[model samples]
Target: MNQQRRRQMAENYLVIWVDGNINMANEHCQNTLTQLCGVVNEVNQCTTAEKCIETLQENSEKTSFVISSGALGQHLVPEIHGMPKLDGIYIFCGNKQRHQEWAKNWSKIKGVHTSIKYICEKLAVAIKQCDQDQVTVSIIDINEGDASENLNQLEPSFMHTQIFKEILLDMDHGRQAIKDLVKFCQEKYQGNRKELKFIQEFERTYQSTLVIWWYTRQCFTNKMLNRTL
Candidate 1:
């Protein structure tokens, strides 16, 4: 993808796969990409450390995870470790023991793994934690001062959320609202087969009484809602 397209495709999180021996023609490489995509939609491949650093700089506002070969990671981690957008780094190589020695020095280094499956599992946990951290409720001290002044001093995010809640509570969420929401979700998760299936199930069998059940379920319903909020 072009640089502009990649920037536009940035979501809540992305994965960057960096290795000196990455070849798209290789079946192993293709399989690794597929496995990583299963956990995060945007999986970018970089054949060199410089390209990986460039990609990270281009999308500096996005939350990113890097999977780097042990050889490259030894040098690359130090260069990108301080990047605020870089969430976690995983050393992918055959010599786990060798990499683990240096990986221990960096707190952001998730682990030294020989398999993509374990990396994906860890990535899922990190992404979940990031999501939870972003959706936080801030309590304001209204009793200490003027309510209006205190409200004005609140963060923009909190104010926006308050307005959204007020508007949502006043509106009538009837059949049409549900249908619209289903349509929006379908468009948002166009290529994600798993989430698309969940959206279909929700559309087919959703009711007002099941609102709490759906929201509490670990599916697209809660994920999308949290992102929107």
Candidate 2:
């Protein structure tokens, strides 16, 4: 194959984790994912959150992106023609993380950067139909992360409870080649020994598709909205 053709066949992918509480709307986790996914969706043409991630995987050679939306794209993006293959992930947690002493417990997430109400509204209905225990889906930011002083002191047990990390092996900053997970699972690893020599040539991580929006918000939106964008 020609060099161009060989390059076109290369695969790229992103690994993402969908927290279980987001699906259950616990502690307002659903609300938090909404905004983060919203800005990602604003730029993507994909209809559902799943498709958004699939789009990143399919066109990975050209562009790679990742977003977690409680399997939001299962219905919306998959039905389309160009929808890419998705690497699915789910994250679970016990009711002990954010806040301290009084702030600890199963509280919903707060201060999500975006809004995912449209999708969460639909997921809520699905849970109800299953006849399971009462499920509440909330969106939480959890972005403040686990290392916060509050959670550390109050819920020491919740420390380092990133469950998905057990399965997903991520190297800090462009570790194991871009899209290594996808190629491994799809069995498309080409076994290029030379590429392995230059492993540090590039740093791989979730490149935000929302850069432009965030800048736009900082520039124009802040001016028009009459507040910090």
Candidate 3:
């Protein structure tokens, strides 16, 4: 996708990859980016700690995870560790033993890893936990006050979400609806080979009885549904 279109997308969370040695032209760097993008739609690369900090500040409203090279993270983590927008930090370095000593001191620092794949595994779990945390329900006691007044006081977004939920629950989705949904997903993930594979699997085997299974499978269905919410 084009940079402008990507920036406009309202993703719940993003990733910041900070490594002074990052070279996009290198096959390893490109592969690492591909893996990160497979997990999170937005991945910003910054070779300097300053650029990463600036990106975090500029997008302060969004939740973010950072993967920093151990050399930079040693100093960088102390500066950005307390930012409310920063959710988690992973120290990526060639020597995990060296970084683990200091990385263990910070609660926000999830782990120190030598392999990008291991980091991605930990990252997926972190992002899933973040998603669960974001899904919140507020309870209002109508018994203590006027029901109408209490309902009127509800946040607009909450009320709208409730209405949308009710409408979806009332709808009877037929075979055509499933087909259309699959087609829409295919179009949306046109060039993403990984997600496209998941879409195809969903199309081939999805069943109403397995809705919960599909929703929790850490694939395109789960990611897409969560983003829609």
Candidate 4:
């Protein structure tokens, strides 16, 4: 094959979702089909995300392109867990207005947020990257932080409640919790970047005492526990 032809037939994927192509990875929705590709037999035609995932695991292990088909597009993406084969993500928001109108408070969805952050912090290091100059790797960051950064104007914040003593109490409790957890991790697991990242992600994601306990355990390694805890 000619060089130009080979270049066109490269293994990299450029998945285009149908019906605005928001995100194909959302494991929720009742349709059962969580992925689509230009290929015919690659998609999971099952009735649920669980079944679809099982089918994919049984099928060809080739690089898959998961996209949407525009219909039933106003769906929220699920927090996909244990998807180790996915190489990257490409989101298409063709002239569609964004969704999500939840209150910007931690107390509302701290559990889910904590879970997501824990996954991202672990997977960020494992994410295989492509050189931009050689071939573009389409990565539509699924974080709210990314969306906010795209906006040009800044939203004003209103200072309402005063909780100085509460804040101090929370801090003191948090420090003690961290100390305890770090000591535990050091006693239990190997000291690695993954463990460290897990701790930081947990701390940032959740605010309550339960989250604090989990974060403290994840924060400690050998040297880390010795120095900090």
Candidate 3 versus the native: TM-score?
Answer: 0.82
Arrange candidates by TM-score, highest first: which order? Answer: 3, 1, 4, 2
**Separate clash counts for every candidate:** 0, 26, 0, 5
Give one digit per residue, the lDDT tens place, for model 4 in 87-167: 432222332223212211212111122122332332222222311222222333446877665332222111111232243
- Lowest summed lDDT over 10 consecutive residues: which window, candidate 3? 1-10
What candidate 2 gets wrong by more than 4 Å, as runs, is 1-29, 42-55, 67-229
lDDT of 1 by residue, 15-75 (tens): 7999999997999998887777666555788989999999899878878899999999999
Report how far off residue 188 is in candidate 1 (Å). Answer: 3.2
CA lDDT for candidate 3: 0.81
> lDDT of each model, Cα atoms only?
0.80, 0.31, 0.81, 0.31
Name the best candidate (by TM-score): 3
lDDT of 2 by residue, 121-176 (tens): 43333222321221222233344655475544544323233322222233242425
Error (Å) of candidate 2 at residue 117 is 16
Where in model 1 is the C-alpha error above 4 Å? Answer: 2-11, 143-146, 155-158, 163-180
By lDDT, rank the candidates, best first.
3, 1, 4, 2
What lDDT score is found at residue 105 in candidate 3? 89
The local lDDT score (0 to 100) that residue 211 gets in candidate 2 is: 26
Ten residues in a row with the worst lDDT in model 1? 2-11
